[model samples]
Target: MVDPAPAQTKLANEQVELNIPIQPLGAAISRYGNATGRDVLYDANLASGRLSSEVRGVFAPDEALNKLLVGTGLKAELITGKTFVLVPVPASQQARQTSSPEHLRYYGLIQAGITDALCDAQGAHPGRYRFTAKLWIAPDGAVVRSRRIGSTGTPRSDHEIDAALRRVQLNKAPPPGFQQPVIILIVPQGPGVTRGCDRP
Candidate 1:
């Protein structure tokens, strides 16, 4: 189970502008907590023994922790804003690494099969419209189901989106309690069609 960090509510979506150097794990995390004014829970022995990489940019609290903890064979699980637990990396990895829905939109894995599914709906399926879809993934990482959040202005495209989602697979299951479904906007290739999507 994930440990709860204190002040959990307060730190939600907290971003930090960090410029820490490569140093002992404890020192880096200590400086991080001090700078961000957040509480961190970790074992002194473990934190003191490992070395952390220098993180020199803006990042979320958890993302920063992940960056700092890289190659340490450790991971930080925020139980609450003020509390974080250090767990073996294998524990988290063995459970199927989950991809946060918000992060999936930028994933380069948008396969053509999905858009190709629109072959019969209308020749307009390609280069005709952009489709945004909500993907609900199961614990095993299979996109259990999906719904069209918005349409490509055509029912045919909407159905085609659903067909395409069924073919999409996730690398791992959704995290324990992912709040929102993943949204992917698919732009059919054509004159104005682009392969990638804009940041949400």
Candidate 2:
């Protein structure tokens, strides 16, 4: 039997009719979400002083969302089948974070661990979808707590991700003064992309 498409994928491909006009970013997002039956989440401050791009016509929910975000210095990230969060672009985010070698090493370790955990599950692989999360790791390298920003488009996959993360223990502790609630962003791979699930 063929497996059904994941909820995230289905949501992205589903077309919706939208007639949102150029307006405040916050208001536009609201209208888009209401029209598409999806939830859009973002900090109010981020929407302040920003205007949305005009969007009209039938288009995939993702496409409409992208249109609304144009020139707004923000991007819509699907966290679940019906939820999205607006976050600053990667370029802007990178400018605010530490990029030292030590930090990079720790970041790699964290990502590798997360990848392994997600890959172990049938529908929770990283490269196939996109999501964001906040992780609180203890000094001893254990993921003491985790807060997922969105869904994997399915409750089963979301559960798998949460279960996997609860057991994650990095190889080493983070460097001194490392930040808490490490942000993790996983973006979908492009066409013809494939990734093996070899433990890191």
Candidate 3:
């Protein structure tokens, strides 16, 4: 079994500017990035103010984005005229790591296969879905398990993404010397769209 998703690293600042796609209406619509690209987040689609396409990785549903802006009076609507664009959210503390050489060895072994599964899974999705797949590795880098730390896509797609991740395998020994667990956060090749999918 995989370890649970790592908690967001305690942030030093309350709000950070995520590389989100905003419409000319000044409404954020999507987010991207994950471990596959070493969780590199990017900004896309914007001209002066109005948005160019439907945001792809805001994580939350359109209604949620609307709710978030309710107090602010800004509307969150999907743009139908343009193609959808994927963007990555801001990087968080939990997304990064500082490991020793031994840990690096295990990280390499586990991440190689894990990422491969991600590539295969992302390719299957119609929308470019990107998000962080957080993994727990031993001090030597052996993978314990993985979870979507962040995401952008449909709810069913998130489930599909989770299913795809479950197919990954880590059948190797961890690096020498370390016995503690290690964590690896992965970002898929596509954009993530899994925000505000909360339960009451």
Candidate 4:
């Protein structure tokens, strides 16, 4: 859980000009750090394959950061006036650490596999709904099983999401000590959501 009071107090009155484009979450965060002169620290896996909203106008750092993370199911916690870190929303937080290079690589592969599966079918395109999924992957990169924790507002959509996950197969095996039951949040497209998934 994050306490927004400190960030609110520190950045309530400071505004800066920003022109970050809708891009990968990690790059967008780097741009935010540069534009706001603040250090944003986070596990690289948290941003892997995630898209950020564009921040194109003058706004407080906190507000801009919030805008930048619109659909990614993440929030920033201020560590200091000059620093912040990204964390999963309270309900989605999992007991996993993804700091090692091998772990990060595995995470990226898993996410890419899931994204491809979700985007391949119109009924299950991730940009159309919101839900949380728990995945159990095999050593050879196949998604052995999956369980979704929320609905996509309809039984058909829920079935579609499950079907998509069933088709996921990563390019490599997970690293040692990588936790099981990976938790992933899927959300609809909005202000900062990544575009181009609809492209042919």
Candidate 5:
């Protein structure tokens, strides 16, 4: 006699499984405070299934989220058709599921490296040079966009910066799951070198 089909087999072709990193809302706020060297307090309200992190600063939500989950294996999901932070099904429940193509997190290492090189080549003056670079990243850290911000540098310097950034590629996954447009500020330390956003 023929055996009956399993229930999992029926749903295997109809669902998707995603693994996302989650941060304690409170810890995230505190970390952001420490990173920016700001002694500010943040408030988190998770009333309607949404987590709102409010801190006094100029950081975008995605930026803040990235900072919050630093070092955590978790990743954010920013797909247009899906909601954020959804719950994952139990492993037992997924036995028959046809898993979706895995997701990826793209980073901007090469672009960052080139920017550092340009900064080194440009020597630091007595003042600051605030420039912005547009980064193009893939789902798992493959840089797709590497253009200079429109108003972040001098006409001559901007061109140079653009050229420098073109050499960068997303060589690794960013944090995880989330991919969106990001603008970064590059401050020069000396000719062909620079540092992260801290010390002048």
Candidate 6:
């Protein structure tokens, strides 16, 4: 008789808390997967040499993973209710998901604007903090919403990051009906040493 398929691990049913800090992309992912007993399939070539932001909060498996991969340019999708696959996103697709890059110069200009704003804020307030968020830009170069994926420990810092993102003025608005939310991570190079928002 044929062997029965292994029971799939359902992520939605799992509840777990995470306290992972900013580190190499591979290490963070591996650590989380191992701790939660979740099998995460990934390509070493793509995940290698990449850095990820920290994740510290109580959340379900899906929510925790979402926070972990915040600014890593990687996405996780649930397959078979238990399996998670990490995939790289292309620049072209980013536009389609968020909005058509007609006025915006794709991510180059968009990300630069965000980074500059974040750096400016970090310079003003010195501390160890990482803000991971998703921004929904309007068609008229307005920020419709800035949702913080995870806390930056202090409400004060979180407000600063939120304000910074809102302060960003895109040269061109995206195409209507496709205002795709973009991921932005504001973090420090070390402990209260260097602070900059990185796209990777």
- Model with the higher TM-score, candidate 1 or 5: 1
TM agreement with the true structure for every prediction: 0.40, 0.48, 0.35, 0.49, 0.35, 0.45
Looking at model 4, the pairs that clash are: 53-192
Predictions in order: lDDT: 0.58, 0.71, 0.38, 0.72, 0.41, 0.63
lDDT of 1 by residue, 39-129 (tens): 6677677655455655789988777777666545567787765567786666556333335553344243434334444443333344556
Error (Å) of candidate 1 at residue 163 is 61
Candidate 5 residue lDDT tens string, 67-173: 44332223345443211341223344333221223321122444445545554544432125666666544444555556665544467656655665665655665
Question: Against the true structure, whose TM-score is highest?
Answer: 4
Runs with alpha carbons beyond 4 Å of true place in candidate 4: 1-96, 195-200
Best by lDDT: 4
Question: Across residues 1-200, which tens digit of lDDT does each residue of candidate 2 receive?
Answer: 11112223335577987888767777787777667767778888888866666688999988888877764668878787767788877774544444767877888888888877777766677776767877766545767677677876888878877787776779687664354457888777677644546643
> How many angstroms is residue 72 displaced in model 2 relative to the true structure, after the best TM-score fit?
29
Off by over 4 Å in 6: 1-11, 96-200
The segments of candidate 1 whose C-alpha lies over 4 angstroms from its true place after superposition are: 1-11, 91-200
Cα displacement (Å) at residue 199, model 5: 19
- Lowest lDDT 10-residue stretch of candidate 2: 1-10
- Cα displacement (Å) at residue 80, model 2: 49
Residue-pair clashes per prediction, in order, are 11, 1, 43, 1, 26, 3
> What's the candidate order when arranged by decreasing lDDT?
4, 2, 6, 1, 5, 3
- Model 6: per-residue lDDT, tens digit, 1-200? 11113233445667877778666767887777765767677788767755555567777877778767654567887775666788876677654655545434555456666767766775324236666667655444565556767876777777877777777767675442232456666565585545444432
Error at 126, model 5, angstroms: 12
